[model samples]
Target: MAETRIRIGIHQEVRHPYITHNLVGVTFSSLQVIHSPPTKMAETRIRIGILGCANIARKVSRAMLLSPNTTISAIGSRSLEKAIAFASENHFPESTKKYGSYEAVLDDPDVDAVYVPLPTSLHLRWAVLAAEKKKHVLLEKPVALDVGELDRILEACESSGVQFMDATMWMHHPRTAKMKEVLSDPHRFGQLKSVHSTFSYVGEGDFLQNDIRVNPSLDSLGVLGDAGWYSIRAILWAYDYELPKTVTAIGDPEYNESGVILSCGASLNWKENGKVATFYCSFYTNLTMDITVLGTKGSLRVHDFVIPFNENVGPFYAVANSRWKELSLGCEPEPSEFKITTVLPQEALMVQEFGRLVQGINGGEAKPEKKWPTISRKTQAVIDAVVASIKNGFKPVEVVY
Candidate 1:
């Protein structure tokens, strides 16, 4: 097939599904669809905007480029020069407009969706503003940095009839699906008794000084926000939506210096059945992400949670440990070990999946499932409990709702 020329500022009429006659705080009067093949003769595509020129934006923008149906229409930064420079350096040749502030991107009539990579503190403010502008939102992790804030943003999206997602990239990755499959083998693993997962990497000097990981208000919850979120999500998916009855956390008393819990260990007791699970997360350790699940019949161990492709660095897995650990108790365990098979980079898959979902909703192909909101809300509640546990001297905090 011949390549189609793609251009910016070319309004490709796109249709939205079962359009609401009216949405609160949002003017959908201009909502319409571009049925004609993109004018310059390119394939159908959605125009995306970025709220800032942060490094994470670099990854997301790259993923946008990878998607044939998405384009980086514009970018807004605190500085005009920085914005333009970022767009240019990132090779966003298609309608690469730059703005002096985030509001510019939010107000841009041509930008269909906005990717907000701002700090945790600014997530809700910018997300609500973007949604109000009738633009879909792809926000950075820890969605709101807190439960109250996340709830507010969620409310804004629902009220405005806008699509929004927390940029928890791994949630959209194919590896997670594969992980789920392996975890579902109840006959092989029997029952899940515990889950211990971790994610940590050394930070650059300046990053250590200013990273949100070290911000007190941002870390009010603890390392659970920084790394435990992924573990929680993974465990939940592994257990087929099974939730713990209670979750209690322990953090270093010097949480301020550590920002959030620089490190944390959590205990999760399953509801009704009383199955117990444990997790640990920290920012003050060498790079590592390993999750071990202890079951009645056997066990499953995943070496890396964030990115499984690093299997070369032992980012592999093991199963049925006793099969190989009979003679020596401390001997290395035996389990199924394999390498990543052409996995899509996490960020790229997330953007592509998000873009596809946004386009699907816009095209009336699918309804945004209720599960998304539940996942985000429940995740925040878990983090909230982590905070309570830390404040109460590692006391176990129960999971509510």
Candidate 2:
């Protein structure tokens, strides 16, 4: 095979999924930055109040600062001192308020929106309350433990006419849009056939022993919520948010002593289109985040779908309509790599999008985008089906809308 007909991908600088690593907001790689086209910034920046001092907040706080249409107005933790320290350590503006209780931040009239990165158990309570308080909600993924809980949050936001968007950062990345465009093209990518995703990371020392993700009291969903959520979201995104007809737990899932899931896999069947999807998520495996989608004409593969190794550029490989060479030594038209560059990390883009939605609502210019909550509900619904299948000894559980 000719060298030009060979395919390869370069991956580097993988980081711990939970811990903070990349801090520089300006540059991503040695490659020159390719900026997005200029656009008008919102006239009014949304004031954001963060709930809890979770480690994830450290990265998101920086994102809010980088977003031109959003600002962190307050941060709250169980301990006022911790909140204050978090504010100081994260370099929040001096005027950003620190609250001892999450409710206090919700009560603050100045805060236009709240970013809820609290544990899964607390999402329903805090997210609903934020909506009732007229504060827009930017919720973390696994929006709720199940569809029932998610419905309540969505209902509250609908009742109050407040915007609700889950913090699935990768969905906001430019690369995601590019991939969607490719998959939607009938010529380049024919009918979608299958999607397989794997998201796992090694949890060393304190994480496995004390992390809320493994604690049933705080995050009963465990790795299913922490890492699996991303994989599930990716699968659903590739399927264009269509709910699977049935879901079956594929392998023997692992659980901690507390009965929290540590590792799991499931296969989903779409009856109408005859499409199938499978995903694996684990906390005990080597670091890997991959998503592969196959179609009649082409396939797309992304190694770092959950969190791109680089902050600025996201890369995916694709191959379409290939044929064997004369001697069948190798195929013609090797896979091509596509890179989408961004001025800010995907998290910052999420914050900016949320802020823009809130700004439009406040100005009476646009209504909330129902697509966000709709997709979130569908994701949780499939998760519920997967759990049920596992409990039923790997039986096929029908996904109820």
The candidate that achieves the highest TM-score relative to the unseen native structure:
2
Go through the candidates in order and give each one's C-alpha lDDT.
Answer: 0.68, 0.85
Q: Residue by residue across 201-279, what tens digits does model 1's lDDT show? A: 6665776568766776554445667677887766666666666778877455334455555667777777655476667
For each candidate in turn, the TM-score is 0.82, 0.89
lDDT at 224, model 1: 64
Q: Tell me, what's the RMSD of every candidate?
A: 11.3, 10.4
- Model 2: per-residue lDDT, tens digit, 341-376? 777799998997898789778877778989999988
Clash counts for all predictions: 8, 0
Quote model 1's TM-score: 0.82
